[model samples]
Target chain A: MDYLVTHSPALIVALPLLAAFAIPLISRLGPRVRAVLCLAVLGLVAALVAILAVDVHAVGIRLYTFGATAPEMALPGGYMVPVRIMFEVDGMSIFMGIVITTVAVASLIYSLQFLNGQTGQARFYSLMMLLYVGMMGLAFTGDMFNMFVFLEIASIAGTGLAAYRTNMADAVEGGFKYIVISAVSALMVLLAIGILYAQYNVLSIAALAHYMQYTTLDMMALGLLAGAFVMKLAGVPLHMWAPDTYTVAPAGTTPMILAASYTSMYALYRITFTLYGGHIDTAAIGWIVIIVGVLSMFVGVMMAVHQTDIKRMMAYHAISQGGYMLLGVGVGLAVIADPVALANYGRDAMNGGIFHIINHVFYKAMLFMTAEAIFFRVGTRDTNKMGGLARNMKWTAIFYAIGALAISGIPPFNGFASKLLIYQTVLSFNPVLSVIAMFVSLVTLASFAKVFYSAFTGPEMPGYKEVREVPKSMLIGMGILAACIILFGIFPGLIVDTIVAPATEALINQAPYINAVMGAAP
Target chain B: MSALSYEAYAVWVPIVWVAALVVIGVIVLAWRNRGQKSYKKGTAQTDIFLSGIKVPPEEQRHVKAENVYWGFFEALKGFYSVLMRPHTGVVNDYILWFVALVAVAILILVLGA
Candidate 1:
């Protein structure tokens, strides 16, 4: 037990990575053996993350160093600055861990049947495992260079998965676009990392935070990192690749890819709140984040409201949902310097923002799966070509309704719980932005309602008369997320008090993070 | 499972609200059950009437997704036009927008500092 707790972080990233490489070789045994192996590997990783979450919560931040005499020896005895790579499992990292593991396991279950009889099954499973490893590493890594390395691993694996259907032109095009966008943004992030390393002479995020002076060089690096992550996260003008990539991604992978985008959001927060906390211009940077978020919200929804393709519409809404997260956290960042305001509303705003990330992941992923379920059974993503699916695909319809209501912030769903937090706290900070957010919620509802009517409730279309409920594995996959939505909605306070509060505290307070790596100032 | 409150400014007790909605739903159902006893299914009473003209077929009766919000689309055409200008689906244009954002962010961070 002690050994497991001590080495869980490394195991979480390493286990999946090792299995990802071994999958192709394992496939020679048999498909059944390979499938069992994949599930067992993912299940073990999820268990490890849960254990890590508990340990981190009970013992504050936990750091495990690679190539050290001891796992906890971030700084060796004789060295002034630490030289080893490390995994920092703070509350925020564990929180993201919970999100990624839950989504990955469920998505894998969904894919079990969604990709049945497809060619290259072994390679598909391998790429999926690699994607999971990349996301886990991104959330846990303490070193900036490792973060970039993990980001590339995720982007490349995701590109391969996005183009998994090589026969389709759109699939290949989507993959091409994603790799192009990812390569450029990753290059920028690398440049920023280089700039920081040249000046600060450290790769550890904790060390950089301890030494960040907000010089012009630091500002330039910050700008590059911010741009790259925002683009990666699909925030507005940089979001063009998302609709295409998301719409063309194979079933089950769509939600996983979306989770990758949220990981990018996590990186953005890490850089802004942790890396350059005290010396930065809080109000200016805060408003900049807020503006990008607002634009993303408005433009994403407006575009979604007009999309004819079901997947494309959902992709736009994903961008819009991301904006809410940025808005809430940006408001918090803007007021971090003012103790009075920070105490009054900024903390809650951050809570709302951070809470929304998990909530959005669950509901958005389920919604995308439902869209894919429709495509799987009816052979069309065009809403115009669908009608009265509820008559046959009852489970899919119910799941879609749950996801739509939750995402639209209707009563008694998780989306309302998180959005309420944002609306109330943001109203205190800025009423106009709050109003715009509420309006966006309403627009989101209208858009989903249109899709529901066109796809599920209308007169039975001739083409879809034989459509049926998705496979049991797929239903089980969506059922997990839907259950989370309901549970979260019913117990919003419990979730916020336990999971979100620690993460919110972790992000807002930089001293604890820095002190964990470098002992508290003499 | 209890109420979620935010510093006394707002409270959301979803369980209570859901219960109330259920009760109201029961009352509405009771009220609905007490009316229209004379109406018969599969009779002339069920025939559709639109401005005293012939009703459209079931297929035509259902609205297509694209036409669901025609009025909103017409009213907001200008807003959408300006918004859609940047979404040209070109890779170069996408990169350009990202570059512009980086430049603007650097200026803000430097000047603001």
Candidate 2:
């Protein structure tokens, strides 16, 4: 029964794709009806995601293979029957599922008025729905090639969303850069997949991991894969695309885009740990990845510190925060290849990395949404031109401040908790790593201080002087994120144990992944 | 038992890695701290590039970042021009980057195979 329910992971993927198509068509019939329909799909998605999260919690492993035959779990004595297209739901998938759906529900509800008031709102909702489809697809996919397809689908849809405000030249430029960079990244992914397919004759990641059997393909696939995902993950040198796109995208779509892409990063983890068998030595590629991560962290924060544009600054900080997440994951990978190291600090590093990702998605999305609200109210994303508007938009200021604190890793905010975990993990491994992570945190704090001072605290400029508070719907969206930010910040353990642990386990435990696809237990 | 070259490059790679990392770390830290911090009381040789560049109390400020990477590009100006690159503001350079990337990938994979 669980298998039947789980295999229907396509529904998680399909609901939004179907909704996206349905939204624009329904909007033509009636605007009010469109709102209700979008909300209904959102509600259904949230409920289903919650149900799946519960299933993952109760059961250690749940496999949902598409197009079912007699469901079989072969024991040690029996050989395997290949039932390919599957969604393996463990703890991590569920946590990400919950976060994605919850944010979708909130963002869509907020966009009701926000989009309704704007022109071509039907198109906006459709793009957003497709965006959700891509993200949910990412969270649930247990394979790599399919991950790229969804990545492409999401990226193209995101480009359209960024360009929705067609009146602005910068917005159009952002969209162009976004599409071009993402296309290149996607090309890299396709080439990498081609390489893997030629070698393995399989598209399923779990099968490939089993087939690896500790061969050259292990390193080859990984080396190829790291570059492919490095572009997607926006690690350092490849991160040039993110700032411009995020800065110029639609106000309502900003958070959703970050949430979607970040989920892809989570998928990268699923590929590395679950599909690749977590068998390769971290020493192979660990240093290169760590250096890139560290550089991104420092560079992101440094550039962010200098930006007068609020959205652009946040974009740089997003790149930096992404570095923190990657740094932890990279460290964990380094040691996971060695049995002795895996037992000690490797698990901690992995824990910190995954934890930071979850914390990051919520806080970062909220931060972006907060930026959006400010944009809607002021008609600009420039922080230097405006000040003292916080007094007028009190709730927004509070929410923005909460996000600012959280992103800076300030105590009791979600960012601080995960960052602390990362720092602790890195410290246990190497003194230098701890210093770098802490330095990133400090840089993050300093950048946000600049944001607060310039954007919210300075004297109210001419245009913003009369700007009023945004719609209640927008506040509700932020309010939900604000609560989660506080909730996760204070009780990092809950998030760690329930969500992070299972996902981490699924990533670390190569046995089931390989065993599922291949007949033998290696 | 595996054909993976884990040992062949081990000794040199580790030393090189350590040296590169130390150098990179110091460089990154220096770049992050590159700005006005009020340190000197100096001479007529103080220019914008000099740390002791004299200015009225308010005239001094951090360098604008829009053109911060100008020097690096200036050094590569002739090469970038040949490639028709950097600030052409044309979308074709981006397309070329993709083409070159894919070409490199194909070459590597054919060899790897």
Candidate 3:
């Protein structure tokens, strides 16, 4: 047990990658066997994450170096340079861990049923595991180049999964667009890493931070990294591929793909808070982030309100919701230089942003699953072709209702918990941004209301009269996220104290992050 | 239950809101249950009344998804036109937007420094 807790970080990433490779061979045993194997791997990964989270909470940051004589030896033989690839399990990384594992478990279970009759089932599961590995590595890796490598892995695997349904031309086009966007963004990330490597002579993030001088080159790298990650996260203007890709992604994988987007978001936060901490112009960068967020919030909803395709509309909403996170964190970044302002509301804004990450993942993933559920039964993604599905798919309708309400920030749901935090804190920072966020939330509710009435309520369509509730496995999948939504909502304080606070602290204060790898700065 | 807040700015105890909602829901349900229960099922009393206009078929009476916000769309047509201009769905245009943002970001960073 002690060994497992100590080495869980490396194991969590390695297990999924190995399982992804071994699954195809294991599938020859039988479909059921393959399914069991997939679940076992994902279950173990989830358990590892839970264990890691507990350990991280109990004992500050947990470091595991890959090639060191000792797992915790970031710098071997007292060398001034730390060259080994290391896994730094900090609060923020573990927070993302919780999210990735939760979504992975639900998505794997959901896929088991959703892809029952499809070919390439083994390949799909393999790619899913690979995506999981990519996200995990991206979260935990302390190396810049390794982060880029993991980013590419996720992008490739995600593109493959996005284009899984090659039978449709739109699916192919969507996949093409996704890869194109991913390729451009990823290249920028790689270039930025190269620029940083050229200057710092090391790829370890902590070591680089300790050596950071915030030179012109460093700011250039920051620009490239920030742009790449923001684009990857689907912040507006660069979000065009999101709707096309999400609308056609096979069921169950869409949520995992969404998690990948949030992983990009995690990368963005890392760059600004950890990588560039206290070096750059906080207000300038913060306002830049805020403007991007504001545009996304308004433009995303504007596009969503007119979308007739259910998944397409939800995709736009995803962009809009992302804006809330950026706004919260942006406010924190803006005020970090002012200790007085930081205490008054900046801390809360960061807390809200971090907390909303998990809440948004749970409810938004479930909402995507519900949209896919609708597509599964009625064989249409167009809302004009769906109505009164509530009568037949009662469980699905209930799940959808829970997700919609939670996402719209309706009282007592998880979205409300996080949005309330963002709202009040952001209000203290600036009233206009708060009002814009509130307006975005209202429009979000109206947009979802339209989808609910169109897809679930009203008179029963003759064509869907025979539609029955989705299979039990799919329900269990959504049920996991729904349960999380309710649990997190009812006990927002517990979650914030346990996980969100730690993450917020980890991001805002870079001293701890740097010292964990490179000893206390002189 | 502790509230999810770091300061005295505001408190959001969702459990309290949830309990209140449940209480109000039960009261509303009880009030609704007190209504007259003698109405006949499947009779003319249950038939649709459209103010003397002939009732359309059930399916036809339902509003389609596209028409849900017809008025809102009309009111925001100019704004939407400006918004929709960039969403040309072409791959090159998408890349163009990305490159444009990158340039703007690099400029800002360089200038600010």
Candidate 4:
């Protein structure tokens, strides 16, 4: 058990990577075998992450040094800095790990039938595994350079998946746009890492955070890191690539991309809170985040209402929902200096943001799966062409309604719980921001209601008379997420107490992270 | 099972709201049922009505999805027009937006610092 706990971090990432390579070879056996292999591999990764989360909760941060005899050995010569690649499994990282693994498992199960009989099945599964590996590695790694490497891996694999359907010219175009944006963002991140390494002679995030002096170069590097991550996170004015990619990607793969986006959002929060906390102007950067978030919420949803394509509208909703996270965390960051506020409201705000990450994953994936089911049956992405599908696709309709309610922040669903936290906390910080968030939520409901009315309710359309419900395996995949949504919604306190609170603590407290990496501070 | 509590704000079980909804729904259902005659299928009473005139189902105009929010869109016509102008669906424009954002972020950070 101790061995499993000790090596879980490395195993969680490494096992999937090994399986990703092994998949193509296994593909020669049969497609069914390949599908089973993918599921088993992802299931194992999920179990490992669950174990790691439990271990991190039971003890504390789990710091594993690569090629070291001991996990916490920072320096061979007893030097005061970390020089080796380390996997730092804190509460926050483990929280993100659980989210990624859970969503990846569900997505892989969904793809079993969603992409059945399609050509290049083996390649699709392999790329999916690689994307999973990249997200897990990005979430778990403590080194900045390692993060950049993982980001590249995720981006490349994601681009391939987005362009998987080569029959569609738009798919190829979307992939091209994604790769261009990813390359530029990766360069910016790499430049930031280089500047940090040149200044501190270290690639370790915790080490640099401890030794950071907030110089001019450090500020520039911070901007670069923040901008690159924000771009990757699909923040508005910069979110133009998202709708195209989401619309073009295979249905089963969109959820994975959403997970990847959240991983980058996690990086953004990590950079702001853990890496640069107390060393920079929190209010200035917080306001910057808040502004970006505000714009994203307004612009993303407004554009969504105008979109006729169902997947594209959901894609815009993704950007808007991401804005809520940024806003919640930004409010917390903006008030970090006030101990009273930090204790009373800031922590709650951060909790809201982090909680929303998991909730959004479940509901958004469900929504995408529902959209896929609609597309599968109706053979169209346009809502105008899809009416009264509920008569045939009963399960799909129910799942879509659950997802629509959840995404719109309606009560008795996960989105409402998290958005409530964000609203209450941010309202105390600034009433106007809360008002904007509420307005956006209303618009979100209207947008999804548009989808519901067009795609599910009203009179049955002429062309879809022959359509039926999606396959059982697809329902099973969506059922998992729908169940999670209901559970998380009904037990918000449990989730907040168990997962979000510790993660929030881990993010705000940098001293323990630094000490874990560089040894206890003398 | 436990409720979400932050400071003085508490959201316990959703049962209360559910029960209230059930009760209100029952009342509404009962009220509508009071003194109402059951209409037979394919009768004049069952036909659709527009401005006090019955219209045949086949001939009735079904509201399109785009028309559901027509009033809202009409009210915000100017806003939607300007907001959507930049979403050109072109890769070059997307990159331009990204670079412009990065520049704005850098400027904010540098100047704020």
Scoring each candidate complex against the real one, what DockQ results? 0.53, 0.03, 0.59, 0.44
Candidate 2 local lDDT, A1-522, one digit each (tens)? 565365446677788799899887898888889888988888877777777777777765566666555323322234243436666666667767877787777678667767655788888889999988887777776666778887888888899999898999989998898788777777767776777778777776666666665455445555556555666666665666778788998766877777766776777677667766445444644665578789889878766766678888898898999888888888877777677776666776777788887788777777888788888878778765556778688888898899888898876677876776677668877889789878878867877876776667644555566888888888888888889987886566667777777767767676765565564444
For residue A92, what is the lDDT in candidate 1? 91
lDDT tens digits, residue span A45-156, model 3: 8888999999999899999999888788888775787889888889999999999999999999988899989899999999999999999999999889889899999998
Task: Identify the leading candidate in terms of DockQ.
Answer: 3
The ten-residue window of minimal lDDT in model 4 chain A covers A71-80
lDDT of 3 by residue, B1-113 (tens): 11335334344556667888999999999999998788888889889888999999998878899999899999989988998888999999988988888888888888878
Off by over 4 Å in 4: A520-522, B1-12, B15-36, B51-60
* Model 2 lDDT, full chain set: 0.71
Alpha carbon lDDT of each predicted model: 0.91, 0.71, 0.89, 0.86
Native contact share for candidate 4: 0.43
- Per-candidate interface C-alpha RMSD? 3.3, 12.3, 3.0, 3.4
Q: Model 1 over residues B3-60: C-alpha lDDT tens digits?
A: 2254343446877768887999999999998989888999988988799988887877
Clashing pairs in 2: A7-A64, A92-A503, A282-A334
Model 2 chain A is weakest, by summed lDDT over 10 consecutive residues, at: A70-79
Clashing pairs in 4: none
Label model 3 with its docking quality class. medium
Candidate 2 CAPRI grade: incorrect
Q: Model 4 RMSD to the real structure? A: 2.3
